[model samples]
Structures are given as C-alpha cells and as structure tokens.
Target: MTTTRTNKAWASNALAFATAATVTAIVTFTLHARVAADETPNSRPPMPVAQTQYKLQLSFEREQRFLGLIQAASRSQIGFEVPGAISEILVREGQAVAAGSPLASLDTQALVARRAAAAFDVDRASAELELASARTQRRAPLVKSGAISAQLFDDTRLAEKAVTSAFAAATAQLRALDIDLEKSVLRAPYAARIGRQLLDRGAVTQPGSAVFTLTSIADREAHIGVAVEQAQFLEVGQIYPLQWRSQSVRATLLAVRADVNPISMTTVAIFSVPADVEAFDGEPVSVSLPRTEPETGGWLPLSALIEGERGIWTVLALRERDNATLAVREAVEVLHVSGDQAYVRGSINDGDLVIADGVHRIAPGTLVAPISSSSVTLAEH
Candidate 1:
C-alpha cells in the first residue's frame, strides 16, 4: 500500500509540471508576437479615407423644366356653303381623310329639279341666240341693199338685240344654278382627321354652319410656356428634347411669341414635332432648358457634406499642418445640387482634397490617409 501511494503522488506531480510548462510557453509566444507587431512599419496607421479633387467652376448650368401643351398645327370647323338638307355624311368622327375626300353632301332632289329646268332654259336661249344672230345678219344686208324699209330693218335689229340680251341672261342663270349644285357637297380641304361630327343626316343646315371639326394630321406642335427670362435663351430652329407621356421626343424650335401670358406670367414658345411621332392633340408635355447661373463654386460629391447648425453645412477636407495630414472641417453654402454632386462655395480652395464619403465616423482633427478615387462616380437618386 505504501509503494502504490508513492507512485500515484509522482504521477500527479509530473502532470502539474507539464500543465505549467504549457501555460508558460503560450504566454511567451503571445509576448513575442506583440513585440514583432510593434516593430512593423505602422502599429496603428491612420484611417484610410475616400477622397476626390475639387474643381472650381465659374458658372454652372442648371436644368429647368417647363410645362406645355400639344396641339394640331391646323384645326378648322368645316361645313357646306349652301343651305340644304343633309343627305349623307361620308366620313365618321375620328376618320382619317385625304385632301379632296368627300365629307358630306346636301340633299339634291330640289337642286336637281332646278338644275334641269335651268338646262332647258339654257337650251332654249342658245336656239334663240342662233336665230337672232341669223336674223341680224340677214337684216343688215337687207337694210343696206334697200330691200326692206329702214324702219323695218331697224325694228328687226332692235328685236334681235333684245333677244340677245335675254339669251345672255338665261345663260348666266343656268351657270349660277350649276354653281349652286356644286356647292351642296362638302369635301375635306386638306389631309386631316375628323375631330367632331357636328351634324347628322336629315338635319337641315344653313350656310356657314359647322358640320365637322377637322384637325390636320400632317403637322403637330407643342406650345410651351417658359419663364420670360428663360425664354430669351431659346433659339429658333434649334433642336430640343421634350417629354411626352413618359417618352422622350425631339422637336425643333419654331417660334417665340412676343406677348406674355397673363395668367402664367410666362412667354410662349412653339415647337414642331416630327411627323413620325405618335402624339395626341391637347396632351401635356414638358421641355427642359439649361440656364447658366453666375456664381463661383466648386463641384464635390454630396456625401462629403454634413449638416451643421441652422442652415449651415460642413465638409471634411484634408490639410497638411505641423508635418501631418489632418482632416479639416469647412463651412460651405450649397449653391446647387444635381444628382449625387453638389456645387458649393465655402472656406475651401480649388484642388482641395475632400473626403468623398463616411464623414460621420471621422472627427474634425483626426489624422487621415486620403486615398483618392481614380474616377468620380455619380448616380441618379
């Protein structure tokens, strides 16, 4: 029993010594690793920051959009010139018609009867005119040769002249009737689309009354109202982009009216759209114009700016002072913002290194290693 107890004590002591040696070795390795890390180039380097260069600009172009309306180039109320009962309407509403296409016609039963009667009168007049001419020729010779008495010859000539006048009057009446008949039919004056049908068949219409509203399909125009100051920059015959029904279309500037709109307090600008574009009349559209603002500022990423006390803003810029690069806070006034970039003028100079992002985590005087972005990135919100 004594020998067994001694053996058990020896084994316990050996296990204890082995555990202590393992612990010591681990502690020594940790200390050596720490020392090696301290001897390296930078035990704790400055925080790396994304930066961008500031480019100073004398002015900036700001895009401004103006609303407008689309309209057909020509809209007209068309109707027949003669007063008559409507016999037929050839075209329906919204129908496309070519130039000279028949639109409607007036009832011609009475007109036809009158024209026939006038034709009979014209035929009778022609026969009478021929007989009168023969009689005048024959009577002239008779009076000269003294075969007939002077008084009788003169009476014959006078009767012939009266017949001639009567014949001319009858012929003119027939021609007038023919014109009235032709005027009873209405036709399209140009290539157009029927916008409205104002009258129906079997309705009697007077002269100059509207029968249809036709809108020209060949040409379309957009009439945009822009600010008076902005309109001055527009040039006639210049091409511009327009927004129509969520689509982009190009149009040519046609004219700028001299008068200003009283309600909108804007000037009117007219633009002509291409023929191939499918657009509706009286639709809404918009045009954008770039206007230069006279101000000196520099462009920077919006991420570089931070909000400060009441209407003030802050941006972190890298500066070298006391032989160390330090982050310097600048107070700036934002002149304009487009997409992800801002035009600002403040206590900053051209070519100043501005932190592009992550400004919240950094302090004003924190040492920073400015790693410039190779290229600036901009994205629409």
Candidate 2:
C-alpha cells in the first residue's frame, strides 16, 4: 500500500510541472507579438516629391541675332592714266592720304620734250601772224593809193587769216601737252587708306594698271544678302540694333535692291554703320532685329519637354485631398529656347508643379510621394 501511494505522488508532481511550463510559454509569445505590432505601422505611405515652376513672358516669335561682316564704306583701285616708268613713290601702305595729295610721279622726260616743242610752235606761229597782219595793213593803204596791185592786197588778207588759224591750232596743241604732262604725276582722288603698292620706283606700269588700292572708312556700311521671304520685312531708312564685342551699335538701312540675284535668288540690302561705332572692313558682327511686341511668357525647364510620336508634351502634377496625386499630359508649343529655359505656351499655369527632372521616367496618373528635390544629390560627372 505504501508503494502505491508513492506512485500517485510522483504522477501528481509531473502533471503540475508540465502545466507551469505551458503557461510561461504562452505569456512570452503573446508579449512578443504585441511588441512587434506596436513597433510597425501597417498603413504608412511615402512622402510626395516637391517640384518648381518659373514665370515667363510669351510672345509671337523671339528675335534672332545673326552674325554679319563689317566692311568699309567705299573702296577703289587707283591707277595711272598714262604709261610711264615710275620715278618716285610718295605714299606707303596703310598711310592716310588726302584728296589731291601727290601719291607718286613718273618720268616726265618725253612729256617735257613734247611740251617744249609745242611752246616753240606757238611762238613761231605768233611771229608769223604778226608779220602777216603788218603786211596786210601796209598793202591795204598802198592799194588805195594805187601803189600796190589789188591782187597783192587780197593775197595779204588771205595770208593773215591763214596765220591766225595756224596760231589757234598751235595754242591748242600746247594746252594738250600741258594736260599730258600733269597726268604723269599721280594724285590721290579722295581721302583713303593706301593698300598694297603695285608699282615701285623704276618699275614700268601700263596705262590703267593699278598703282595702289584705296579704301574709305570714315562712313562704314555693310552689304548683306537677304532671302526673298525676309526681304519683304526690310525697308530703307529703318533702324536696326547691332551688337559687337558687347557693344551696341545702331545701323540704318540705306537701300535695298529691287531685283533679286538670279544665281542665289536673294535680294541685297545695304546698311550704313553708325559713325561713332568702331568696326573693320570684312569683319563679322551680330545683328538683333525685333519682330514682335514684348510681353510676358511662361518659362519651364527644358527637361520638362517630352518629345514623342505625337510631338512635344509636358506632364503637370496635381495634388488632391487625402494626399492623392494625379498627372496630366498636355501638348505645348515651344516659341523659343534660351539656355536651359524654354518659352512655351500650353495648359500649364504659372504656379503649377511641372515634372522637371526625370520627366521621361514617369507617366500620367502616376501616384508620387512628395519629396524635397533639394535632398537628392546628383553625382558630378
């Protein structure tokens, strides 16, 4: 009976130990699940990204500036009228010359000889005419007094008229020689800068051969070829703004060609540069012409433009209540592009949030978390 009682006691002890272990395990599991549930929020959403838009002015068409060449007002190739050996060269290249200044002289030996012969002829003719006049006067009185024959008087009168004609011819020859002598020396025709010398001392030059090139820069002008379509917008006397080397210059349209060039089909326009503006011949410059009235337009980052099969488009992000987001794709007409800013007209408003960076990665009606754009750091290439 004692053995049976010990067995019952052992069985009872084992049952209590098993029950205590099961209760401890249940309490530890429940506390761990509760702690995990409290640490994690089940319905948290991401933050939305912030975007920026810039206000811009819109116009019909932005003015375009074009490059052009600067040129002298006038240019001429100076030459001698007579052929002769060069005796002297007075002007040097790049020298400033005035009108009527002696530029050079040629050997005048032959011209001087011809002039002397002409003067001798004039003197001989004058002497003959004086003798004829005296004989005619003396013979007229003799004929009246019957001291000389009437035929002799007629001969004297004819001789006087013939001598008078010869004298006049000789005088004209002297004057012709004088002009030829003066032509042997070349003079500047106008104020200009001398270019390369074609003839040097002792060099023989032919008549009409270039002696030097002269260009006038006091009043400058530019000749430009304009297309037929653009020619219609240009008019004579219209003022246009020009910029060169960060300097502003005003140019006036002097004239426009009525006929178009057959080869290029372009009209030629001549513009006079302002006198005070500094420029050089054949140097290129930039011209800015205003085409439309000035007004404000919308400006957006160039990244916002999405070009696809349908053309360029932009995505505008809209925010709604309950932190919901929506995007709308709209067609945009780009007027002009300057640097990274694009002037466009579309459904976008001034304060509207347009997808700037990473525009091509997103689509319309996409849910986006608003995040600070400044927080994203771009790696430098």
Candidate 3:
C-alpha cells in the first residue's frame, strides 16, 4: 500500500510540471511576437503629400460696411398762432409747398367782423378829430383877443385833446385787428414738403398746437452712428457714397457730434446728401468707409493658417530636415480675416514657404515634397 501511494504522488508531480512548462511557453511566445511586430516595417506606409508653397502678401486695406438712414437736414413743426377750430386744410402730406403758401386755415369770420368794426371806428374818429382841430384853432384866437371868457377857451382846449386821444386809440385797435386776421391762416414758413399731418380739418387746436410737420426738400442728409474708433477717420466736408434699396448716392460729411449717443453708445455723423436725390426721413442706407491708413500685414489663404493654443494661430512652413523636406510650425497673429483669406503679421516673414492646404495631414517635422502652387491665387500687397 505504501509503494502504490508513492507511485501515484510521483505521477501527480509529473503532470503538474508539464502543465507549468506549457504555460511558460505560451507567455514567452506572446511577448516575442509583440516585439517582432513592432520592429518590422509597415505594410501600408503613409503616402507622400503633394504640397504647395504659398507666397506672402503685404499692405491691405481694412473696410467695414455700416448701415444708416436717410433723413431731412432740417425739420420744422408748424402750428397756428391763434387758438381756433381748424376750418380748412389745403395741403396734402408729401406735397411740396412754396414759401408763404397757405397750409391750413382757422375760422376767421369773427375776426373779420371785429376788424370791420375797428375800421368804422377809425373813420368816425378821424371826422371828430378834424372838427376838434378846427374848434381848438378858433379858441386859440379868441383866448388871445379876450373876445370870449378865459374859462370857455380852456374848456374848448380840453375838449379838443379828449377827441384827439379817442382817435389815436381807435387807430391802434384797427392795426392790431389786421395782424390777427393774417395770423388766422397758417402759411408755410419756407419752401418745404409736408412730412406729416397731425390733425385733419375741423379739429379744434390751441395756440402752438402742432398741425403739420415740414421738411426742407432742398437739403437732405444721411444720419448715421459709428464707433469712436471709426469716427476718428471721418472728417467734415469729406464725401462718401451711400446706398439704399439698390440706389446709390453721394453724401458730404456735414458734422460729427462730440457727445456719444446714449442708446447706441456711438458717435453721430451727419452727411448732407444731394438736393436732387429723392430721399425721405428715416430711410435705411449703407455706407463703407475706405481705410486711408495701410495696415502692416501679409495675406495668406485660409488653408495656410491653423488654430493653436489659447486662441492663437499657427502655420506650417517647409524646412530642410534629414536631407528631406519637412514641415516646421511658425506662430502668426491674425490681424484681419476676409472671406477665404487671412491677413497676418508676426513670426511669418515675407517670402515664407507656407503650406496652402491639407494642414491636417501634416505635422511638425513631417516629411514632405513641396511644389509651387500653379492653381492657387496668391495674395497681392
């Protein structure tokens, strides 16, 4: 029994040893296979990129389009001088009117009757004054000759003075009535167009009540607001082209307000338009300011620039590495971006060979074969 038990223990130990050997061989083969796979050449290598060198451009203009409105150069609100119910409105909105043309009328029947009564009083007072003058002359002669009592002569002089005073008062009243009669009719103060009608005929209006709004047709303006930086470029008397609804017009810079507008936080610029150009108040228009100052930068195609860390930009330039063409990165600061072009300055000097496209396929120190871009349009200075 002891011999049989020892023989079974030996067989068990041999099985354990064989099993350990198989596991060790498997682990060793796996490690060697991984190392060999890493050392061997790749079956599918990266294809060589067809690269292009883009030339640098300098001197560009910065322009921004702004929107504004066409407005009247001068506006006036018309009102009646005397309080009365409006009797007639003779002018229509948007109608051109000459100076002194009647725009509206107030009821003048009562005023006219008073004016007639004043005229009649003036005529009667004139006849009485003539009779008083004759009596005063006759009394002067009598008082000097002592042909009549002195008291009677004094009474005659006093009567003459009283009648003369009455005559003067009546004439003053007549002159005042004539002025009121003329004011009953509202007339255009100057040659202008009716912009708006506040009240219709028969509407009761008080003195100084706005009845119509008039805008001068001979002068028009473009009222636009711009940032403080942009305002510095504008000068008084400078002419600029303005567009509205496909219509183009030229306007001369009339004024630039020093105070900033509270609502838009911009400075106001008023440009006087041509008198013949048909424009209305508050009509929207567009204007572009030509930059007089040249900016120091170079323009590159959009494909040449790459986004970098912290909102910075980068470009891959071709350089010699390992006796082969390799891409090297250069930092650039984008001054302005227009459409598919980027205007940049910094790090990238003039005549740098920057990759125009396929930047994603290229990395720093990447091997490449660069060729001149025949089809790409290079930016001009």
Candidate 4:
C-alpha cells in the first residue's frame, strides 16, 4: 500500500512540472513576437504638403469701404408768388430749363382788365393836374399884381394843391397794377431739370404752394458718412476716387459737417462730383479709404490656420528631424483676416516653412514631403 501511494505522489509532481514549463515557454514566445513587430519599418508613406515661406511685415493697410449717396447741389420746390387759377403749364416733368424760362402762367384776364382801368385813371389824373398847374400859375401873377384879393388867390392855390395830391395817388396805383401783371408768369430762377409736376393745367393753386420740383443739372454732390476718426484725415478741396455702379470716378472734397448722423453714427462728408460724369440723383455709391494699422505681423493663407484650444489659433510649420521634414504646431495671434488670407504674429520666425493647406490629414510631428510654393505671391494686406 505504501509503495503504491508514493508512486501516485511522484506522477502528480511530474504533471505539475510539465504544466509550469509549458506556461513559461508560451509567455517567452509572445514577448519575442512583440519585439520583432516593433523593429519592423512603418509601411505608411510620408504625406506631400504644400508649403510657403513666412515674411514679416511692420504694418498693414486695410481698405475700408464707406457707403454714400449721390445728390444734386441745388434742389428746390418751385411755385408762383401770386395765387390764381392756372391757365397753362409750359413745362413737363424731366424737362431741362434755363434761367428765366417760363414754366407756367396764371389766368391774366382779370389782371389785364384792372391794368386798363388803372391806365385810364392815370390819364384823367394827368390832364386834371395840368389844368390845375395852369390855374395856379395864372393866380400867382394876379395876386402879386394886386389885381385880385389875397384871400381869393390863396384859396385858388390851395385848391390846386389838393388836385395835385389826387393825381399823384392815381399814378402810384397804376404802377402797382403793372407789377401784378408781370408776376402772373412763373419762370425758372436757374438752370435746372423738372423732377415732378405737382399741378396740371387749369388747376387752382394757392400762393407759395409747390407746383414743380426743380433740381439743378449743372452741379452734383456726394454725401458720404464716415467714422468720426476717419473723417479727421480728410481735407477739404482734396480729390478722391469714388465708386458708382462698379465704375471709378473722381470727386472733390467740399466740406465736413460737425454734427453726427443719427442713423449711421458717423460724420458727414460732402464731395462735389464732376459735371462731365453722368450719374442720377440719390444713386447708391461707395468709397474706399486706406486705414493703416500699426501691428507687426506676417500674412498666411487661411488654409494654414487650425483652431486651437480656448480660442487660440495654430499653424503647422515644417522642421528638419531625422533627415526628414516633420510638421510642428506653432501658436499665432490673428490680427486681421481679409479675403482668403490672414495677418498673424506668433511663434513663427521669418524664413520658416509653413504648411499651406490640408492640415487635417496630419498630426503634429508628422513626417511630410514639402512641395515648395515660392512662385505664389504672399498676401499684401
């Protein structure tokens, strides 16, 4: 019984030892396989990246566009001085007229009759005054020669003075009637274009009521609202370029108003447009003014920019590592963005090679084959 038990124990020990050896060999083989895999070369090829060289600038000028409107230099609502029923309208809307050109006329039948009566009264007064003057001259000689009583001669002279006063009053009334006759016709005060016809023929109108809207054709103006700070840079009488319907035109600076525009919150600048240029009143226009900003930065295509943590921006730059070009991230502060480019100042140096585009395909420290883009011009703004 003792021998059999000992044999059983020996078999059990042998089985345990074999199991331990198998486990140890399996672990060792797994570790060696991992080591061999690590030593193998990476199968993925290097990425091709377009690159541009960074060039630093001291400052940049941003073109600012200001919107404005074109207008006539002189605009007025024209009407007649005297009130009457309109008899004729000689001018039409959009008609060009010169100074003193007849625009409209009032019915002159009543004025003409009154003028004739006044003229007849004037003629009767003149004849009476001439008879009174002759009587006064004859009485003066008789009173001096003592042929007539002094009181009687004095009474005749006084009677002649009364007739003379009546004659003078009649003459003044005639002159006033003539003035009314001339005022019946409405004429243009200056060279202008008729903008609107407010009244038609035979329409009765009151005095000072607008009959037509006149806009001067000889002079034009541009009213532009610019920021108060920018307005200070403009000088009166200086010439500036303006854009009208995508075409460039020159205008002279006329004045700058002191009050700020309520809607735009900007100061107003008046400019005189050349008469030779054709433009309609109240047309929309714009002007570009160069605003220089003092900031040290460099320009890069917008594609090179990468959104970083906490609102900061990142740019990938190429560096020499292990005899191969590798992409490295550089933090930048974006000063200005215009068009497809941005002005940035940051950890990048002037002469550093920067990846221009396709940033999402690679990570930092990524090996890349840089394709030079030196032929392309850098952003100027």
Candidate 5:
C-alpha cells in the first residue's frame, strides 16, 4: 500500500513539472513576439537630409552673351594714283599717320622733266600769241590801205587765229602735266593707321597697285554676323547693351543685310560702337542682344532636378502636417537654366519647398526628415 502511494506521488510531481515547463515556453514566446513587433518598424537608422525653402523675388534672368572678334571701322588699300618708279617710302609699318600725310614718293625726275617741258611750252605759246597779235594788228592797217590783198589779209588773220588756238591748247596741256606731277607724291586720304609697306625706294609700281593698307579707327563700328533666325527679330535703330573687357557700352543697330550668306546662312548686323570704346577695324568683341523682356518665374536649385521617363523633373515637398514632411513628384517647365539654378514655371508656388538634397533616393510620397538651415546650401541663380 505504501509502494502504491509513492508511485502516485511521483506521477503527480512529474505532471506538475511538465506543466510548468510548458507554461514557461509559452510566456517566453509571447515576450519575444511583443519585443519584435515593437522594434520592427523603428529599427532602421534615420537618413541624412537637407531642406530649403523656395525664394520669390524680382530676379533678373541671366542674359546669354556671344563672343565676337573686334574689327576696325574702315579699311582701305592705299596705292599710287599714277604709275611711276617708287622713289621714297615715308612711313613704316604699324605707324600712326595723320590725314594727307605723305606716305610715299614716286620717281619725280621724269615727272619734273615733263612739268618743265610743259612750262617751257606755255612760255613759248605766250610768246607766239603776242607775236601773232602784233602781226594781226600790223596787217589790218596794210589791208585797209590797199598794200595787201583782201585774200592775203584774210589768210594772215586765219593764221593768227590758228596760232592763238594752238597756244590755248598748249597751256591746257601744261596744267594737266602739273597736276600729274603733284600726284607723284602720294598722300594719305584720311587719318589712319598704316599697315605693311609693299615697296621700298626705287621699286616700280603700277597704278592702283597696293602700297600699304590703311585703316581708320575713328568712330569704329562693330559688325557681327547674327544667325538668320535671330537676325529676323532685329530691327534697325534698336539699341543693344554690350559689355567689352569689363567696360559697359551701348551699340546702336545701324543696319541689317536683307540677304543671308550662302555658306554660313547668317545675316550681317552692323552696330555702331561708341567713339570712346576704342575698337580696331576688324577686331571682334562680345555682343549682348536682348531677345525678349524678363518674365516672372520660379527658380530652383539645379540639384532638385530628377531625370526619368518624364524627362527632367523635380520633387516638390508639400507640408502635409506640421511635423511630417511629404514629397510629391511634379513636372516643371524650365525656362532658363544657368549656373547652379534653373528658372522654372510649374503648378507649385514660389515659396514651395523644393527637394534639392536627397533627390536620388526619395520618390513620390516619401517621408523625409527636415534638416535645419545650417545644413542647406542656398544660392541665387
């Protein structure tokens, strides 16, 4: 009977121990599940972020400027008016010369001889005219006194008239020779800068042969070739602002060619440069042409742009709640993009939040943590 009682006590003790073990297993699994549920959503580390508020102000659109070479106003190929052997070159290359200054001299020996011959001919003609007048006066009285025949008197009168006409012709020839002699000494036509001299002393040159190149820099004009598409918008007498070498100047549109160049398909627009700008006859310069007036638009950092199937896009952060930051993808119209910023127009307002940072990783409806002002880089376009 005692052995039977020990067996019952052992069985009861074994059952109680098994039940306690099962209870402990159930409690441990419940605690583990509760801990896992608490940690799963908030386990990830927070992302680094930068935030910026959009700015609205009267911002001038950055103008697009083009480069052009400076050029002189007028260029002329200076040469001798008449052909002769070159005797002396008065000016050297790269010399500044005044208007009408002697540039070169042709061989004046032959010209001088011709001039002297013409002068002698004029003197001889004058003497011959005096003699003929005297002869005519003396013969007139003889004819009236019947000492000479009427035919003889008429013949002598005709001879005197012929000699008078020949004298006049010889005098005119002398004047022409004198003018040619003066032209042998070449003189500059205008105040100009002289280029390379083609001939030295004793070199024979033909008429119209280039002796030197002369360029007038006074009242220089800037000639630029504008593309045909752009040239069509330009009008005569329009004033365009220009900047050259950090100097501000105004250029007046003088004229535009009606036809475009076949090779370049560009039309020529002539702009009269100010007298003080100091430009050379063919030196190029930078030109700033105003296409249209400035229009109001929203500007954003260039980093905010995201490229995808919608082409270039930007993420606009909408303030859903005071503490929660939500971003939405929006298509924006880019008007002018310049240096680290873009002038854009879109459905969003000027003061809207633009996602400049964290753009590559975030998508539409992304929850973002807003960074403080110290972390954001804000720059004006």
Candidate 6:
C-alpha cells in the first residue's frame, strides 16, 4: 500500500523510542537507589560476644551426699556375768582381739566344785579358828584359877565365843568362791574385732545372755542421719570428709544426736572413723553434710544458664555502654550444679561479662563483641 504504510510508521516510531529508554533507565535507577539509601549511615559492627570472667565466688554450703551408717565406735554385747555352759569359745567370728583377750569359758564344772567346797570351808574354818584360840587361851588361866566352875567357867566361855562366830562364817564362804571363780572367765573389754559368736561350744548361757560381739575395730564410727537442718551443721570436734571404701575418709564430728531418731526422723551425726577406715560393724558410709546457711551463690558456666520461669534463672551479662558491648539480662538463682559449673545467684557482678553461650541467639540491647575468655581457647563445652 504506500510502501506498506511507510513500513508501519517506522515500527511505531521504533517502539516508542525503546519505551522511553526503558522509562529513563528505570527512573534513573530508582533515583540512584533513593539517594544511596539516604546517604547510607545505619551503622552496625558489634556483636561477637562469647565472653566469661565473673570470678568473685566464695559462697559454699550445699553439700548433703547421704549413704552413711558404718558403726563400731564401741559395740559391746559380750554377756556372761554369771551363768555357764559355754565352756570355751575363745573368739573366732573375725577374731583379732587384744585388750584382756580371753573371750569365753564358763564350764567352771559346778564352779570348780564350788571352789573345792570353798576350800573345804577354808580348811574347816582354819581348824575352827585354831581350836578357838586354844580354848580362849586355855580358859584365861582357868577362870582365874577357880579351876573350872562358875557355871563351868561360863560354859567354857560360851564355847569360845561360839568358835569365833563359826570362824567368821568360814571366811565369808571363801570370799564368795573367789568371786564365782573370777566370773567364769569371759574377758575382752576393748581393742577388738570378733563381732559375733553369740554362744557356741556347749551353749547354755543366761546371766545377761549374749556371749560375744566385741567390735571396736580401732574406734570406727560414721553414723549420719542429719536434717534438723542437717543437724545444724554438725560440730562436736569437727573433722568430716567420710566416703570410706571408695576411700577419702577423714571423719571426726563424733556426736550430735541430742535425741531425734524415732525411726529416721533424722538428727544423728556421729562421725569418728579413720583407723585407716576399712569400715565394718554394719557398713555403708558416704556422708557429706555442709549446708546450714552462708550460700549466696554465683558460680556460672553451665553454658551460662537460661532455664527461667517460676524456678527462675537467666544470665547473659556483658554490660559496658555507649562505646558499645550491651547484652545484659541476668536474673539467675540456680544454686548448684557442679560438673560443668553453675552455682549462680546473680544480679551478676565482680568483673561480670558472662554470656558463655546459653543458646546464644543474642539480643537484649545486642551490640556485643566481648571476646575475653582470658583471650579465648575454650572449645570443649
């Protein structure tokens, strides 16, 4: 048609001049990215954190532990102040005795035949007090030579004062058969070990029963019941370490029980042990104790706390200010954890810093960049 309508009006004026030079280079690149984002100056550059350096510590008091029991700070039982029949048991159940040793023997065969009938009534009362002092010294010169009558010299001076009161009742029955032959020999009062024997060899027993137990194992102890506020932090001579078997052993406290065991209502204490603690007489032993007050807390490290809520606890620390280093939070209370650390009480002080990574999301006034974990090396977690 007129040369194809002048080549379609020159391709619609070259497509409206390349759509107005692509809308004027997208409106001059969106106004030079809005004036370089308003002359850029939103500044940012802090946040590195990782910190750690609170130190000041000194709170101590939460120990507790438990397992305790081991006994034998004395243990007695050894009965036999007079019966009989166990004619010889000489110690065995764990033997090892010393102070007075002996241990058993009561077949005094009718007490050595009543001590040979009280030594034949003290040899017939020393032959009736030497025939009543030779007839009261030959009738005191025959009753002053009246020869013999004055009621026959007062009936031979009342038969020599009734033979000197039957020779003083036969020397008090030969001193009660020499104290029943020295209490039928039972012995062993201290330095001991034979913890049990009850009554072996012929048995019989009675006058107070219980034949052998003796224990003492060189003064051992370790009772532990606590809780009257842990027996008010046990005192009596204070020493305390305990553990036994797994070793440690230091003991000492020796007594706190002013009464209060009515079946573990708790409050016993008693320690002592340490004869190299081989621990026996009932055995168990663990004992820790401590806590009675004095614990304010602030150790930290359990990844620097967090758990909050009613049981409360938080941390983060770092503080500084205007020049930067923010992250402050803190709340804490924790009170004890140990192995990877954590005692906490916090409003956090003493060279503070903290933030040793409690999930480290970072925020509270952020700005961080702390770094000083003694110049860093950590890495174990």
On TM-score, the leading prediction is 1
> Residue by residue across 144-239, what tens digits does model 1's lDDT show?
888999998788788888888888888898888788888888999999999999999999999889999999988799999999999998999999
Write model 6 residue lDDT over 108-215, tens digit each, in one string. Answer: 878778778778877886787788678777877877888776786677677777877877777787788778778888888888888777668898888988877677
lDDT of each: 0.89, 0.76, 0.82, 0.89, 0.76, 0.75
For residues 1-381, what per-residue lDDT tens digits would candidate 3 score against the true structure? 999999999999999999999999999999999989876634324335444454454466766777788877678998998888899999999999998999999998888899999999999999998998898888888888989989998888888889899999999999898888888899998889998999998998998899999987777888788777788989899888888779778888999999997887888888888877777778898777755336666778888888987998999877775566777899989888777888887786667677888888777876676764665675543
State the lDDT of candidate 5 residue by residue for 218-266, as single tens digits. 7577767777767787778988876677777788988888888899777
Q: Which tens-of-lDDT digit does each residue in 185-253 have in candidate 2?
A: 899887778988987899998888999988875777877776666778887898877776688777888
Better of 2 and 3 by lDDT: 3
TM-scores across all candidates? Answer: 0.82, 0.67, 0.65, 0.71, 0.69, 0.39
RMSD of 2: 9.1
* Candidate scoring better on lDDT of 3 and 5: 3
Q: Is candidate 1 or candidate 6 better by TM-score?
A: 1
As for model 3, its CA RMSD to the true structure in angstroms is 9.8
Best to worst by lDDT, what's the order?
1, 4, 3, 5, 2, 6
Q: What lDDT score goes with residue 72 in model 2?
A: 80
TM-score of model 6 (CA atoms)? 0.39
Model 6 pairs in collision: 48-369
Q: What's model 4's lDDT at 64?
A: 87
Q: Which candidate order results from sorting by TM-score in descending order? A: 1, 4, 5, 2, 3, 6
Runs of candidate 1 exceeding 4 Å displacement: 1-43, 149-161, 308-311, 377-381
Q: What is the Cα-based TM-score of model 3?
A: 0.65
Residue 26 local lDDT, model 1: 100
The model with the greater lDDT, 3 or 6, is 3
